[model samples]
Target: MLINELSKKTGLSIHTIRYYENLGMIKGLADEKVKSNNYKHYNNNTIERLEIIIEAREVGFTLAEIKKILTSWFETTESKPETLELFHAKIKEIDDKMRYFKQTKRLLEKVCEKIQNNE
Candidate 1:
């Protein structure tokens, strides 16, 4: 399919897809037979890649980090130590954030209880 279809399927804007392409996170190929325009065609693999990108971003991975993960996981023969290290670090970050989330939730609950008592 084309960029428009890819955008529809992925729920991302054309500009975002082009930006990912520019960042080398995903690629689209232009047809060799067509001589009129330089429209790029995307495949199913591109859809999977975009889905990964979207999920990774939702979990707070930067584009560069996502690129590294995709490259290491898909394009490489062996797992790189740095990639492993990066994942470990991300896990630690998430753990720390989880603690904060629990604290915030508790505080909100206490505030809600106080408000209920006063009313």
Candidate 2:
């Protein structure tokens, strides 16, 4: 599919898709036979990759982190320790955030209880 079609399928704006392409996180190939226009074509793999990117972004992963994760999937020679360390750090961060959120929830509940009791 063309970039527009890919944008529609992925629910991402054309600029965001192009930004990802520019960042080397995704790519589209130009047809060799079609010389008149410079339209690029995307495949199912691109769609799957975009989906991963969307989910990762939603989970608070930086673009750089997402790129490295995707690269590690393709490049077996890449350093496993580095990727492992990144994941480990991310896990710690999320855990810390979860604890903080639980504390905040408790505080909020206490405030609500005080309000109800006119304290």
Candidate 3:
């Protein structure tokens, strides 16, 4: 599929896809060229990678982390342990964040209730 098809499938704009490609989030895509009218073509693998990258970002994985995972997948070493460790760490981080947010929410609710009672 081409960039437009990828954009439709991934629900991301072509410009954003280009930006991701430039940012090294997704690799092996063609660079812009004056030839072929400056249009870029993408394969199914690229589309799949874009989907993974989008999901990873949504789950709070930075571009550098995603790039490391992708590179590991491409490298000679198997990445199962590394990927598992990364996900486990992310889970812990999210759990801590959730705990803090819950505490903050409770405090805010108490404050709001006191303000309402006073008014």
Best by TM-score: 2
Task: Tell me the tens digit of each residue's lDDT in model 1 across 33-75.
Answer: 9999999999999999999999999998889899998898779
Better of 1 and 3 by TM-score: 1
Candidate 2 ranges beyond 4 A from true positions: none
Candidate 2 lDDT over residue span 3-119, tens digit each:
999999999999999999999999999999999999999999899889989998998889999998778765665667777888898899999999999999999999999999999
Ranking by lDDT: 1, 2, 3
Clashing pairs in 2: none
Query: What's the CA error at residue 6 for candidate 3, in Å?
Result: 1.6
TM-score of each: 0.81, 0.85, 0.80
Model 3 vs. true fold: TM = 0.80
Regions of candidate 1 where Cα sits further than 4 Å from its true position: 104-119
For residue 117, give model 3's deviation from the true position in Å. Answer: 2.9
How would the candidate models be sorted by TM-score, starting from the highest?
A: 2, 1, 3
Candidate 2, poorest ten consecutive residues by summed lDDT: 72-81
- Candidate 3 on 1-119: residue-level lDDT in tens? 67788889889998998888898766444556555555667777787788788889999998888877777765637876897788898999999999999999999999999999995
